[model samples]
Target: MGSTILPTGMVFASEQNITENSSYSSSDNVGVSIQKDENGDLMVVKTETKARANVARWGAWQYTHIALSTGVTAGAINTAYSKGIGSVLGIFGLPGWAIGNLLTAAGWTNYGNSPGNAVARLWDKNHNGWVGFYKRTGYDGAGRAVATAYKTE
Candidate 1:
């Protein structure tokens, strides 16, 4: 576990693999401490945020596509969401997409959602014809967006 000091004197682990902003998810069991009295009395405040209850974060976004009509590319997904396919399969919305386009998954916390219905494809190094946007339902500790890529139209 890694650690950092926030301006308010809070602490967090670097293990979240998040940078550019300091943050932790609700699902992450983190604690913040406050001095109850100047005499050194202290209390621990725990914060937690779980992913959507209906879908498991680990089973949300796994995909590697060759193109529409063809099918999933063989090695794409394993290389993409390396966190494990089962953990990413259905976290976004449906089970699958049209036969042509493919969903691309990356580090969920790496990029921020673009402004106003913008498809964040520009930030994706492996970007294809990514287009057609959806509400970015995910965020990191800094409240930066972690959008879901559901189409490439």
Candidate 2:
């Protein structure tokens, strides 16, 4: 009779090893106030805007490497339009189209229905508004990679 041997190199830990480098606590006075006007109406009003600044946004573009087959009907054009609009608007609202165009011009093309990725950072100060966009290519299904940050204005 021969004895069988099991493979080695397996290690397991019952608990995770974690270290806390710093802990912070604060003790400060906090207050809240509420006011009502005539007819018991709330005094403060809140409003929202469609587009603002200091928002970091991201978008992906996908162009099919292969063209549509002949005699094959595609879906409604509105679907693609809406998709583009929604993707862009998710970051910059109506101005996303302009930013998208800029990205296309900067080597982010829709060739073969493939789109290049674009990102933008918007900021405003003293009633002045500014938009910055970044475009890149060659991100097809590879493993994780490091991103290099560059300053743009």
| Top-scoring candidate (TM-score) | 2
Q: Please give, for residues 1-118, the per-residue lDDT of candidate 1 as tens digits.
A: 2233333323232333323223323233233211121222111222222322221221132343323211123232322234333343343233232110122212222333312112
What is the Cα root-mean-square deviation between model 1 and the actual structure? 18.3
Task: Please report the TM-score between candidate 2 and the true structure.
Answer: 0.20
What is candidate 2's local distance difference test score? Answer: 0.22
Worst 10 residues of 2 by lDDT: 24-33
Q: Give the Å error, residue 112, model 1.
A: 12
The CA lDDT of each predicted structure is: 0.27, 0.22
TM-score of each: 0.19, 0.20
The positional error of residue 113 in candidate 1, measured at the CA in angstroms, is 12
Per-candidate RMSD, Å: 18.3, 24.4
Give the C-alpha miss distance for residue 97 in model 1, angstroms: 19
Please identify model 2 stretches exceeding 4 Å from their true place. 1-82, 92-94, 117-153
Per-residue alpha-carbon lDDT of candidate 2 for residues 62-115, written as tens digits (9 for 90 to 100)? 222322211110121122223443333333322222232222222222222322
